[model samples]
Target: MYALGLDTTSSALTLGISNFDQINRYQTWDLGRDISIYLHQYLEAFLAPLSWSELEWLVVAQGPGSFTGTRIGVVTARTLAQQLHIPLYGISTLTAQAYAYACSLSKVNEGELIAVEYPGQRGSVYGSLFTWDASNQTLSTYKPLQYIDLKGWQQLLSTEEIHHHLSPDTVEPKGICQAMIALAHQQWQAGQQPTWQDILPYYGSLAASPPSC
Candidate 1:
């Protein structure tokens, strides 16, 4: 069995392929402002040598990161999933960052929380908190994903038993794709299905704040 994963929620375009147990192939390219121009070419090249017929699932990081980049990734994923008639799973970009960190560190103590913050307009950030759930062998969403400014974020962090903090600049695309693949497998096992039509991009914007210049 084969599954493909994509992470374009940030400046990088990460692609992963899982041949059952682990990610067999992982690749990333920094797309920057040319994401729309290069996304399809890169995606096609990434899967060119693979056996697409055996690919049973598609997983993508769907939001709270680069507005244009995230949209490109999701739209591409949705199109492929629909055309291929395979199940698609959407993972939150913030959660993906946290999960990636947790996986990289190997063992996160129970109660150890991970916070992911991506810069947003007007000093606000797109953030989310996740805790290591030892019993479930997975990271659980402790604080719901939200938009908070630096001061507000600091206040919220003071209330948690956080072990790590991650920001946009620190994320590793490879790790993010790995996390996406893991989450996708979990959803597949739990019988949670995804509707391509329901997938949408989340820009994590503040109503009162104007766009960052």
Candidate 2:
């Protein structure tokens, strides 16, 4: 089975296609503020290798990333899923970042928590905690994504003993999309079919904390 993942939650437009475990194609475009203008254009070309009918489900980084970027990506995903009559899976931007960060690590102490943070709307940073699964190469959420200032975040990290903190700046869009697809592919394989109508993006200020799922 094949699936598609799009992450326009950053200035970069990241897209990927995967067949269960392995990603077949992945690309990232640093489109700055013009992502909305070209997302569909590049997406169409990115998806040219496979027929839409071949896609099992659609996946998107429903964020706590860029406000405008997240909205654009989710709306496009919902529309495509609606038209294609397929399920749409919303992967947390923080969750994807955790996975990508895990992949970047040379050695991850499996049970130790890895924290990911993104700059938020009003001077706070969005943070989420996750535990890396070395054997499975997967991640399990330790805490739901939430918004907090740097000081509060530091306190929380100390309280939680989360040693591995990953910066949002260091991650590449390709890694984000890869992680997005992997998360969705796992859910798809498990036979959880969520509708596109229910899919929504998580933006800070509006929704400070959302369930990791």
Candidate 3:
């Protein structure tokens, strides 16, 4: 099965294509412009060497990232999924990042994993904690934090037995895409392929402590 994953959660645009267990291609661009414009251009360029008809699924990093970026990615994924009549799966960006980190630290003896993403205007970050199970190739969410205090990093550390860290700084598109593809394949095998509407991005609770520019 062929799966395509897209992540436009940050200033960078990341795209990945995988066939079953192998990643065929992956790309990341730091396009310092509107996401929609850059995304379209990037997709067009990337898709030129491949045939969309060969794709069986589309995976997207459902937000908790940039609000505008999330919208652009979801909208694009929805449109493409509809046009292609393929299954669409939404993976939490934070979750994917955590998974990526876990894979990188597969040799580590013990520790908790944390994934974080900038929430743009929210003033706080959206993060999630995960316990890595290397043998099962699973990273289970220990706790989900929609808004976290940046200054309380030490406090956050105390809340969990995190001997290791996997923040956004360490995550890469290749890892995110691989996780998305693995998830999509698992869902497909389980006959749980989701519809387009169900693949929409998730923006965490909208409550606010007004953002500081």
Candidate 4:
């Protein structure tokens, strides 16, 4: 994949470089609101030994996450992809969490469902359902991302018979940079090439309204 991946959808910032082979490196920082201040410097130093020109692809977590953090990441990634003239793959934060967990499983049932959710504003939740195919290291979204009340989320999970329910509080969203990179690599290997313009940060009714422009 020879790609650089980023995840800044929370209080932390994560960066990773990978080849989907032997070469893999990653770092995470709990910068909170100070992330924007140190982001450029961290990225520059993290690129180490290899310059931006050497990266063949770019990957980032396009979130259903913190409003400000998600926008910052997507904008930075989009700009880099545009300037580097490389394909950019924006992975869903929910999918990355599911992907990471799924990778650790020893086996899967015939129709296993992995549900991931993050607490949204006002007791609502941002969630998605994913089915991971271990054979090809690919993840398919069984239920698309949505914002719903906790009661609705519980009903959906019970109705769908989800086998695994994951949350950021347990797995830590900042640690999924490698998963984002891996998912992007799988898609790229499958002959998928997404442009930077096609990527956008997902903010699902933050504060029950659209984020300020």
Candidate 5:
């Protein structure tokens, strides 16, 4: 089965294409402000030689990253998945990061929670807690993705904090597409049959809602 994964949650534009057994191609570009403007051009160029009809699954990073970028990425993924009649899987941006970090570790315990964090607007930061599942070599949601102030973030690291069990780790946007693809494959193996309508952006705020096309 062929699959494509996209991640535009950060300043970087990440793309990954894979067959069930191997990753065909993956790339990351520092697009900064031009992500939405050039996403299609880059995607088209990357997919120029690929058979669209053979693409069976579409995976995307539903985010706690750039609001506009996340919207564009999710909307694009939804539209394409609907048009192609392929299963669409939405992976959490933070969870993808945590998975990447865990994959880097030589050893990870089954219940070890990893806090993936990134800066947010003002003095806040986007944080999500995910537990490393040793058996599957993937991550499970430990705490729902959230936006917390710097104080809350610091407190989260305190011994008495609710998420104190979670060990903090950082993940850069570079090479994240591969991790997203891996998580998508894991979800597919687990029999997750998601539709285009099931894809949504997670902006890590109470007032934020999933983008509607």
Candidate 6:
């Protein structure tokens, strides 16, 4: 089965094409322009040589990242999934990052992985901690997403046994694609198909920065 994944939920724009066993990815960061334009160009270029009709699944990073970037990626993935009549899987961007971190840590050592993604707010970030099981190739105890202040981040860093870290600033599309493909396959086997209307981005509730005491 062939799956296509898009992650334009941050400063980076990632496009991934995977065939159950292998993944090919293209990512560019620091696209200081309209995200939609960059996403369209990348998708078009990436899909130019292949027939979109052959894709079996479409996966997207449902966001807690850039508001505009999340919208651009979700809308595009939704439209393409709907048009192609393929299953759509929405994976949390933070979770994807955590999974990537877990996979990396599983290779070199044994410990917990923490994934953090900047929420594009004044002084807030979104983070989740996860434990990895390399023998089974699975992740467990994924902590709920939390909105953390800079102080909270420092606390997490000092207190948590964070062996590996994955952030948008350091995450690669190749790893993201692999995680998405694996999750997509699991969803497909379980008969879970996501719809365009059901896949929405995660925008944290923080109207304004908390005032300092």
Best by TM-score: 2
Q: Name the regions of candidate 1 deviating beyond 4 angstroms.
A: 205-213
Candidate 6's C-alpha runs over 4 A off are 22-30, 107-120, 152-160, 165-167, 206-213
Candidate 5 CA-lDDT value: 0.76
Highest lDDT among the candidates is held by which one?
2
- The C-alpha local distance difference test score for the whole of candidate 2 amounts to 0.84
Cα TM-score of candidate 1 = 0.89
- lDDT per residue as tens, model 4, 1-213: 379999899999999998768888888889999988999999999998888899999998888787899999999999999999999998888888887777766675445898889898888998888886777666788888888999899888888877888878656554588788877877787899889988888888543332111
Q: lDDT-based ranking, best first?
A: 2, 4, 1, 5, 3, 6
Ranking by TM-score: 2, 4, 1, 5, 3, 6
Scanning candidate 4 in windows of ten residues, the lowest lDDT window is 204-213
Instruction: Report the C-alpha lDDT of model 5 over 99-123, residue by residue, as the tens digit.
Output: 7777877566777766667778889
Winner by lDDT between candidate 5 and candidate 3: 5
Q: Model 4 compared with the native: what TM-score?
A: 0.91
**TM-scores, all models, native as reference:** 0.89, 0.92, 0.83, 0.91, 0.86, 0.80
Better of 2 and 4 by lDDT: 2
lDDT of 3 at 108: 47
All-Cα superposition RMSD per candidate: 4.1, 1.8, 4.5, 3.5, 3.5, 5.0
Better of 2 and 4 by TM-score: 2
Task: Report how far residue 94 has shifted in candidate 6, in Å.
Answer: 1.8
Alpha-carbon error at 64 in model 6, in Å? 2.2
Tens digits of per-residue lDDT, candidate 1, 26-119, equal 9988778888898888877888777667789899887777888887888999998899888988888778778777766666777788888888
Clashing residue pairs in all predictions, respectively, total: 0, 0, 0, 0, 0, 0
Which stretches in model 4 have alpha-carbon errors above 4 Å? Answer: 107-110, 173-175, 205-213
| Global fold similarity of model 6 (TM-score) | 0.80
Q: Where is model 5 more than 4 Å wrong at Cα?
A: 160-169, 172-174, 206-213
